[model samples]
Target: MATTSTQRFGIFAALALVMAATRVHLSLFHHDIWDASWGVFFLAGFWLRGTGRWAFPLLMAEAVLVDYVVITRMGISFWDHYCVSAGYWFLVAAYGALWIGGSWLAKHQRGIKLSTLGMAVAALLVSENACYVISNGSFYWLSAHVPAPKSFAAWFENLGDWYLPFLETTAVYVGLGGVLHVLAVQLARLSQHSGQTQH
Candidate 1:
């Protein structure tokens, strides 16, 4: 619990590298699909730390690199790249990270309780939807500049474009990602327990 300066720096650096490398695949493969990659990022940055400021920049950096690399590989100039593409997702992730890191971690660290865990889980789910809605807001701005699809539906179309993929992907991504986080924490606790037993 008492993470030293070196430990904190090491954690941050390792996370950055892991996030950067995985993000490459996420950008290249899913490109348009928001799942598979980002769900893990949200969980890590959110649940792993309580510092909102640190989480925001690092997570955003990881996300940006994915997009930047992919767009460059495709030989597409991002000079006209929609700012919203970058900005809002960062907003969504940052928001979720802060919500989990600040609120959940703060409460849970105080004590282990079922109600606390349930509240944390509920917050995480709501945060996902909030991020989706925020991204759609980004789309709303992008749509104004880009060609709005000509149809009776405008906002609904934008909502569908992002929300559907978000929900479908989060279903798989969040569940798996949650398990990974839980396992990792359990492993850490196990190691600590074993060390204490040996002592």
Candidate 2:
């Protein structure tokens, strides 16, 4: 149990680092890397499932801090930024959707199997879509950036425009995370087996 706790802490730290590193500059490796905030939240839920009471809020704070720094560095007031608005608060719910999806996947996972992979994919899709709806819908309907007299047709079209890019970017990170998770599990099993043999 101690080992599991340590491992979970390690994963949480790594995800937090990834989020800060990718988000702080808003561009990484000279614009080659997209933000990993979405992926980090999902992976956090999976790896740090039981720690959400503190872990989730900590990550959320880190996200806000990173944004504050990035926006300020650009000579823009954080509150005056185009993305900052009443709608912005809805991100809590948007990200919560991702965290819940990941937790659900962790609960349902029955080992590193085909079914597990399917579950992960399903969870990602459902969570990402829900997140998109909440975040995007809130922005479109509640933010001052969007002109008044909004229509469902325009909003739906807007959703279609950006949905794929967000999904694809998040998929890239989560897919990589999935591979690393499988490798870590396999390595742990091998180490355990080796220990048993020595005993």
Q: Per-residue lDDT of 56-134 in model 2, one digit per residue for the tens?
A: 9999999888888888878999899999999998989999998998888888899889999999999999999999999
Query: Any idea what lDDT model 1 has?
Result: 0.57
Residue pairs with clashing backbones, model 2: none
**Pairs of colliding residues, candidate 1:** none
TM-score of each: 0.68, 0.95
- The residue-by-residue lDDT of candidate 1 on 21-43, one tens digit each, is 66676656765444344454455
- Residue 62 in candidate 2, Cα distance off native in Å: 0.7
After superposition, candidate 1 runs with Cα above 4 Å error: 1-14, 30-37, 82-106, 109-117, 144-153, 192-199
Candidate 2 regions with alpha-carbon error over 4 angstroms: 1-3, 27-31
